[model samples]
Target: MSSPASGHPSPPRRGPRIAAISATIALFVAMIGIATSTQASAAPGCKVDYSTSNWGGGGFTGSVKITNVGDAITGGWTLRFAFPGSQTISQGWSATWAQSGTGVTATSMSWNGNLGAGASVDIGFNGTYSGTNASPTSFSLNNVTCTGQPGTTTTTTTTTTTTTPGGPGPGNRVDNPYVGAKVYVNPDWSAKAAAESGGSRISNQPTAVWLDRIAAINGTTSARGLVAHLDEAVRQAAGSTLTIQLVIYNLPGRDCSALASNGELGATEIDRYKTEYIDPIAAILGRSAYANLRIVTVVEIDSLPNLITNVSPRPTSTPNCDVMKANGNYVTGVGYALAKLGAVANVYNYIDIGHHGWLGWDDNFGPTAELLYTAANASGSTKANVHGFIANTANYGATTEPYFKVGDTVGGQPIREKAKWIDYNKYVDELSYAQAFRQRAVQAGFDSGVGMLIDTSRNGWGGTARPTGPGPTTSPDAYVDGGRIDRRIHLGNWCNQKGAGLGARPTAAPASGIDAYVWVKPPGESDGASKEIPNEEGKGFDRMCDPTYTGNARNGNSMSGALPDAPLSGAWFSAQFQELMKNAYPAL
Candidate 1:
């Protein structure tokens, strides 16, 4: 397989580069071996490096360097460090840190850093510490260096005194198993309602119409069309069952913008959703088809201000618009509705993770989690209100993934994890971010002994090549340095493409870290305009269906504008479905 492509605009240019006065200090710090402790000696085969300079404020800085110190640089590497009970990272660089009591483990960022011979790099961290700065006791690289000393070994110990925060609180919670699973069958409620009301097309040309159409038709025969897929997936896995993650994306007033249609569901509309949409689907699952299934429903609280104003059929009275702001509390009401539904059915709920370039650093996962949790909790729902969170539904293609790799590391050393948080490199190109997120989710206490899933629908064939900057003509697939054209037909236009095969499957359960890997979106669905078009594409339905008819006209042909409608022919859809079955479960 290869790296996925990115679909985000280029990052702003940096001002003239200023020479880091810290370079010499950084190098000198690298050589001194810093204050190493017994943790350094615990893993003899993996060389360890550390730093103790306080990066000002309450933040202290540290660095670690690991070398193979073994025969050869083998597979992947994992660097583990332990903080004293009194310390916690205020901010981290180069790598994502997971703390279990005093133990902190940093995994290699997504970008592959080959450690040949004695090649080494430095990964950094910033945190608040109290009491003694205990040196890390053990370092182990996956499938690479084990424990044993190199030709010659030297150890240094440094004890820096700093005030500490409250001791760690239960570490990260166990991850919810429903983190990532692809189980929706394109339930485009709006489109279906329009059709039922004798309208040829959905109002505002909504995207949910098409999704609902697909679900309505498929659900009848296949019990949401997901149960069979899950059964097949489980059968293929030798009866090792995995949860199927689904996205309940048909929220009224979905995208509140001129470019996108609204899915505004007022009290009556909400009731309709519960009765007409949610109830039937729950009933379908309640039957034998989904007896063993684990399901999560994401309200997909998209851009708040946009949805508030643009969404139709809104509440009878306008509520506070500020509440709709990103990470705002407007979702509390929605969570209440969803929680009510959860009372009758087994479902885990999540909010959106936003597309790659959409929010600031702090606005991404951390704040999103807090906001969703607050909303769910405020709705008077217990932990049962939500399962977890999800990243970009469609906007984040290949390019966006690498941009997120800015602060990842390998072997206790910093390396470009990727460029964007949800760039194509991790999704389409490499599966690194998917793996990394699973680990981070575990660290964040979201992993509940169940795994997470990544959406890889149109990303089959590893998406468009990486771009060469920002331009319309640039290759969409280009996002990272080493991504390749995936021959695996997970889903998409090339589902039946001859050379495709089933990609890797999750090796462990969520309790162990990652749970399952499944495509959240169906492939071959249009991206609103030309699949090649950029900018004009709206979120969710806008990305999947071309309301303005831009895509069909540009392609010099018109296709069906209904839910579950494929850009290709029925034969093509069948071929892709069959290919997915073959690759996902070859024996079946």
Candidate 2:
């Protein structure tokens, strides 16, 4: 709920750009051999399983599975091997990859760094090779030999080619994991929705599972744990590709700008976040059972933006924000999470970039993009770890303003200047903001293939009060206010907004550079409690959720537009649910 602001209307949307599709002819070859570990105290034994697929034109994809057969690898592990041919790695996943001449080094990611005796991990890369694509004959773990022994040998090779358009080949990550994949439907939220008066209509829709605390990784008395949800997702997949959305929300000193969603960890508890929180989640996700499912993680909502917009020296700075920025725990925790979770072959990480209202302005936009690049490149993570980003998560910004343009002029003046609500922000809606942000993100050094997602859960703003046409040209304010789709008291007013309605349903590849329109925030969950009702979940009361509270620097001292009688954040508010359904845009 606490995010920054932007000014100036955005430029017009650009035409769809040409996208490249790679055709890969995969050749699956399996080989098994013993890898002797000299560093192990007891019997230093290990095994390596090597497999590869060739993409014509000298391109290939390889998969390596390492199992520790002897003593436990406590601290970390490093795998060193040499390619028999003149093979060179172009891109790698599930680990850090490097090559020196014919020699290759694959280091453990933070999540899979530790392996107990008999435990195994999967890692691979996309490479180029000449001559026969023969598998590596020898491998080493922690500087010990893993292959080329006279053990029982099993080798099999199979070749097949299938082009999925924007998808990666077998054992490789797809460009858009959502395309052609059925998303996991959470039974918990589905039950809640189906139980409501008109909830059955949208109950089956997929929403993100919020693992906001450590307890969520296992189970809470009232909710299923991460493993249970993943297992359910696997069952629902029915042997086909399915995407399970998870919100990685438990960073230390989280939501520093707002108290309602504060996490349990302390400001300096980066270690706990890594070991207790992220590590367990990663372990569960990396399990081979769920490898077939596409895992999309919305990492650490509202964390990084707070560092840029809510830290000291800014007008909206808070003490908690300052502490988080100075300690650098937010950066460390996010980076660590990205690196650990990213090591999973099927997992696709999408960092949260607060809404257009928060970072659509010039000052906040570029700096926040730079900060995202910084975090993505920190804590053993490379930019490749971040698949893409999501915008307007759990916030009420309209998806698109079809009527008035930011460049519109009224009475010989720009609408942004006269429109009180426009606030001189560069973006007027989520779609424009998301597409523009994608370009900037790529310019900031993220992969050009990165996509954008917009949260269209509660920003419909379409009821009887919905604007029908462009506003009058008498004054800028009249024209802008009359034509705007969002009816919040102010762009900063986020909570149980009274006139809010459900926006677009989830859809993949809805627009250029856009991945999907998702309901990241479930329709009925209250943003925060309307009054001071205490609980043990570390959730606190925030005035923004109160209907009577007025005036804050962030909201320009405007009255809090939240509805009355709302429950604590994440609790089911039946009244709100009915209202959302009644006001459903594109009508339920």
Candidate 3:
């Protein structure tokens, strides 16, 4: 959205900001983006995060995130801020915007009228200022003075600092390093969930610690940070060994072509990723003190998936994903990561195998498997180095669709493992897709020992709300049996959906051929900001996240059964957590 004035270029688009729900609420203003740190007081328990975009022509767009740290606002709430300069909001969306003098108030709209204890919502507006556009110095939520916050944008989490790349942890496999150890929980996520749970606490679950990037990047997990995290984890374990899963998430052009959560590396920065990100990470993991720890690395999420199917609608502007693929960066970069990380003694790696909804079809399945093998067996790596693959990394595919007929044709051909789906025994979930992928991997000459993992963090949409009969597909019994999920409009609905329940609880050795049903993406963290506020992150916004985005052909234009205006990915959304808990599959 550039309003170019003659020869003047548009100011850089604003990246996402960490919404601050700082103190009283379990929510945090966890810093994000390039901005000067300011501590502005709002309501007693709340804080306002501000970021600017397209500042030019005496006008700029500003985004403000209001969070209630004092207990859930339960009803209508208002956010008020005083501009430091001549700045005045002209208009806004996602909230009812109004102004008087230099004072402005943004009242909650009907859809976002309420929030759970630590929940926050993003609302921004285009504004005009005479000379300079300085951010508002203070803010108030519900008229109560909030905290004056000071912070900067960074993705390094405490748990991620202590986590590692690859190896077995609690899967209980014969080769698992932490055979008798419990999966180490990331304290930050646990604490946030615990503080917000209020009485419905989910006990003893493990959260994934993510090594999203290195020092060269703006995030926290560099080699030194990883060592510090590991050192601290070892201290927490006392004399016993601990198991932990670390997501090796920062691939070049991460999320490849998405508007949210894009990485520091461009699609063309392959060489930098190797020397700067991966190599140092590998050196730290090779240290001997960490030998007995169970380190499971979720290699990369959303990267390889694009090579098969562009589940996201981001290739339009950040087309570098295709360029990376053309120059072999996508393959080589991933291969380098697998090989370098795999060389570490205790490292166990799993490449992204997407989910049943994304790559379960015939057209995508084979290429992904081949891509996985090619990445695993690249020039310097052996088939033995790449341990396995993970599916549903940051996705919302149901653990089991329960009743779609196997042979249904979308066009003129049978979908998925058509013959295999007819067996009635196999369910349509990550398990089925994993089994099929494992077969494909072996065919590509990888060892048969390769396993599969599914992040059941957000897919189990249990509760009586689940459908009891057939869905709208032309295929017979697309969702016919009892207890089917019919809420999603198409194959690409990945936001924090409305009726979504907690999938499977984290566990090891759940089934044969499957590694474990893990919780890789933390339960309450967001996937992307609701569409109205604009793509703060360069990754761009997809309507799939806009709860209101009705799907079209490319997105399958399916109706997303999610509530509109969810927060950005990786931020805590108390409302969503409450929904997930109430609807948890095995019943919280």
Candidate 4:
């Protein structure tokens, strides 16, 4: 979690002003070099000056300066180099390199080698580069440096090691690969279910459902007890050494914009969140039964629109559109709350990335990163407090046809600029923007390894197809793919639906830069609504059936709204829970 070195060179500036200035200088320099040169034989060989530095997150940046030392000549040549560290080169370009522990070797691409004599070329490498940047005692061309020849240019490699004073050591685990699941207590019905079915009935309910039921069962006592039971259930369902993703969704004013009745959380309301919601959850997690749990706090629930706008300075007439913007101080507030609850130790706080439509190009890249950085630091949380940014909790995956452009009747058409506000085309389609933001974070000393957990829960049939373009390709619409959105992978409820029985599990090995594919949201359960209307208001099946139902038909009916009359049926609830385990973690 340490920051990058201070004296590192700034990244090359892009866009109009900078590009124009660079062009002018390049033209003038070319003219002078051409005038001063006469014969091609007098052209000097290329000179390479290289340097590297570590940034502590298994990442590093390296710069290579290639200068033409001979008489004026046109064309490029390759520059070769090596790395002496223990890090995997996650990404690289303009040059190719391979790594083996403390030894890394690289050769420049064909195009990079074509440089005019007396002219200079600068190239950079950014990715998972590690170790000290001490000057390599020896370097060679093909195998040997130029010697015994006048005007003979030799490859000169210089290494400057820069170490940032303070940062987290390698021992600290700060990343969460799992997509989180909802967990909260429903006082009224949970108590009723617990009383009617006994402990067995209570244990059979889904995690959030059971917790709510327990709260109602014996008031605070049931609340405390439910935590233990939930832990046991998860352990049994996901293996003893399992890493589970638990989402704490009791934020006072969750999704205030979507539902006016939800109300917003003011100063006093935040205090209550710490007491009633955060404290109890922390206590439950603190219990010995759940000792192996790794928690991640995903700020806000259901995309609270304009959350950021409320606190950020804005004109009275112009409201900020981003929720996190309004609540610019929420990250600090949550950090303070977590510190007080003694829960920060086990939690990796992640602020939502919101849907592609919400954030624009520049704002998404620069300002968002600054906000996250400020929030973490102000909250008394270091880089260690955060794992990385996450994208789309319960939303669509990447697709080809621009979803934002598809109107009611029109399928494919050039989108108007006005619609650009909500158009995801400007944001989602640009992978370089995401990369630039991540690179900026790296430059600012934050970990560049980002994670995007697509909501694969209900996006199966409705998912967008893959995207294809120039630079690194990412899904234009959110969907599960093997490309690295850093440690790329998909976390959902079920996998390979057509394969083995209902409970069959899938593999976790990374495909396409993705490290693991996991099931964060347990399948076979309702998405908190009837099947007909996925978002309809209802207490879900747990509220209607016996707290112990363990059949698929009942669970499926409840999820699909086929069993509206039997919301808390025990048999129905048990069936859904059992089916989830069967489908999500069959190995367990």
lDDT values of the candidates? 0.36, 0.77, 0.60, 0.34
lDDT of 3: 0.60
Q: Note each model's CA RMSD in angstroms.
A: 13.1, 16.5, 27.2, 16.8
Q: All candidates' TM-scores?
A: 0.48, 0.73, 0.63, 0.45
lDDT of 4 at 365: 45
- Indicate the TM-score of model 4: 0.45
Badly placed stretches (over 4 Å) of model 1 are 1-88, 92-124, 127-242, 257-268, 283-289, 296-330, 333-351, 363-365, 399-452, 460-514, 529-588
On the 0 to 100 scale, the lDDT of residue 516 in model 3 is: 79
Candidate 3 lDDT over residue span 383-473, tens digit each: 7777778877866667666655443333333333222222222225666567557656766777655677878887787787877554555
Model 2, poorest ten-residue lDDT window? 1-10
Instruction: List runs of model 3 lying over 4 Å from the truth.
Output: 1-179, 215-225, 311-318, 403-427, 467-483, 532-539
* Candidate 1 lDDT by residue in tens digits, 1-588: 001111212122222111111211111111112123542322224466565643223345565655545333323345654564577865453355577777776654322233455566456565676655555544444322234454333443533222221111122222344333323323332233233433222112211112232244244442235455445534533444344445454444343331222333432344465565555555554565454444455454353323322223332112323323433334544565456545534454554544333322222334444544455555556544444444434322221233323333323322222222223211232233333343344345442222334343333322233322322212222332333333221112111233332232222232222233334433323233212222211222333233224222111132322233323211123333333334332222
Per-residue lDDT of 305 in model 1:
24
**lDDT tens readout by residue for model 2, 290-347:** 8889999999988998887887787788899899999999889889998988888788
Of the two candidates 1 and 3, the one with more favorable TM-score, higher being better, is 3
Number of the predicted model whose TM-score against the real structure is largest: 2
